[model samples]
Target: MTLVGRTAAIGTLDEVLAECFAGVSRTVLIEGPAGCGKSVLVDTVVERAAAAGATVLCAVASPAEQDVPLGVIRQLVHGDPSLALPEDALAAPGVPSRVQDTQSFCAALREAGRAAPVVLCVDDVRFADDASLA
Candidate 1:
């Protein structure tokens, strides 16, 4: 479907995309109430990034898994089983914790970015686990 009434969002995302392509670090957080086309808007951006030859990694948070630490990160990392985590990467504790896992995820993301322009997209972040979101 054609994206309608999202010229501003699209323009903003285009700027971020341009920065990413230019080897500049950037982050864009899109938030809105449910059924307000947030997902659609982000999906459009993802498509644009891919079409521009960037490697796009995406994770969609699930309400049922919100209590699972690193659940969202795990989804992104494991989206392609070939993506390897470092041997020194710390595992998530039995209890939900943020720092170690997020650090590992970020490191892995940095490594992936070395191969190509990496666009990390997290959808439904409002439903992401506290540790992951924090």
Candidate 2:
């Protein structure tokens, strides 16, 4: 693997991102320590996905505000105002507590993926809320 900077393993990430875009799994999770280049890998994957005509959604877990509900999902839908939530899904009982407002955003993501594969990157998992992690 070629190191892009002092930390990022660019070459390895590039290969993985390529496979991700090729519809290998549709979901790619890159986990590592704070300074271990996970964000760098996500960035590389986003770039490659864009180049391949895929939509990219990204969310970062913040250490200072890990309790925020649907923080990651909010970030993913912020720019795409047209995205809609599923009707009444949020009001359903026994729905996973961790995934709030799930109907709309989840449906929006599924719709986006139908048009073209979407690369959703969730970084800083260690700082993510336990509910969100579930």
Candidate 3:
């Protein structure tokens, strides 16, 4: 559905985007039941990020059984090939593999943001595995 004329949440998102551009890490966790416009909020953030010259990476989880691990990372890496994986982090035994991957991906995204901001969007986080949540 189109989000035209949706001001209240979009205005708040604009404020959040301003903060992100001002060097604050934007980590907004939108929570509500279905049809509450959570995805719309995220889409607005992404649009703002893009307008501000920020790289955007987005992933959505499916309820189907064939989903893969680090699907978000795959999307981010696909969007920007310069995003690198840290070798040292992957070698650590204690780290959950996906966590290491995600962390390294985030680090790369943050570093890239130094040149131009980056926005990493992960949808259906409620379906993410506990290990991924850690």
Candidate 4:
């Protein structure tokens, strides 16, 4: 479906993608009130990135999952098996281990970008699990 009234947002995303392709890493946050098409906009951007041969990783936050530690992180890593944490770092079924710490998460994110320009699209940040957001 065609997305209406988001030409400027798409244009900016195009610029950001270009910069990332050029080895200049950056992050873009798309924020808006609930039911304002934020997810649709993000999906459009992800589509563009995919068409351009970018590695796209996505995670969506849900109210039900908000209390689950590292819930968002788990979702993000689930799409890419190479992102699996070492057994030593893996927490019990639903818990986030101390070894799966912020430092390690950031390190992994950087590593993914280095391997291939990655477009990490996270939606519904307000509902993201608090621990994961940290």
For each of the candidates, the C-alpha root-mean-square deviation to the true structure, in angstroms, is 2.8, 4.7, 4.2, 2.0
Sort every candidate by lDDT, greatest first.
4, 1, 3, 2
Among these predicted structures, which one has the highest TM-score?
A: 4
Per-residue lDDT of model 4, residues 1-134, tens digit only = 58789889888999999899889988899988879998999999889888888888789989998888777778888857666655444465466557446677778778877856888788887899777787
Clashes of each: 0, 3, 0, 0
TM, every model: 0.81, 0.68, 0.73, 0.86
Please report the TM-score between candidate 4 and the true structure. 0.86
Instruction: List ranges where model 3 is wrong by over 4 Å.
Output: 1-5, 65-67, 84-103
Off by over 4 Å in 1: 81-101
Q: Per-residue error at 56 for model 2, in Å?
A: 0.3
Please tell me which model should have the higher lDDT, number 1 or number 3.
1
Enumerate residue pairs that collide in model 4: none
- The lDDT for every candidate, in the order shown, is 0.77, 0.63, 0.66, 0.80
Model 3 poorest ten-residue lDDT run: 65-74
Q: What is the Å distance of residue 97 in model 1 from its true position?
A: 4.8
lDDT of 3 by residue, 1-134 (tens): 46866777778877877777788877878778998778887877787779888777787655551244443344446645578555543244344455657777767777877866577777877765333344
For candidate 3, report its TM-score: 0.73
Candidate 1 is scored at a TM of 0.81
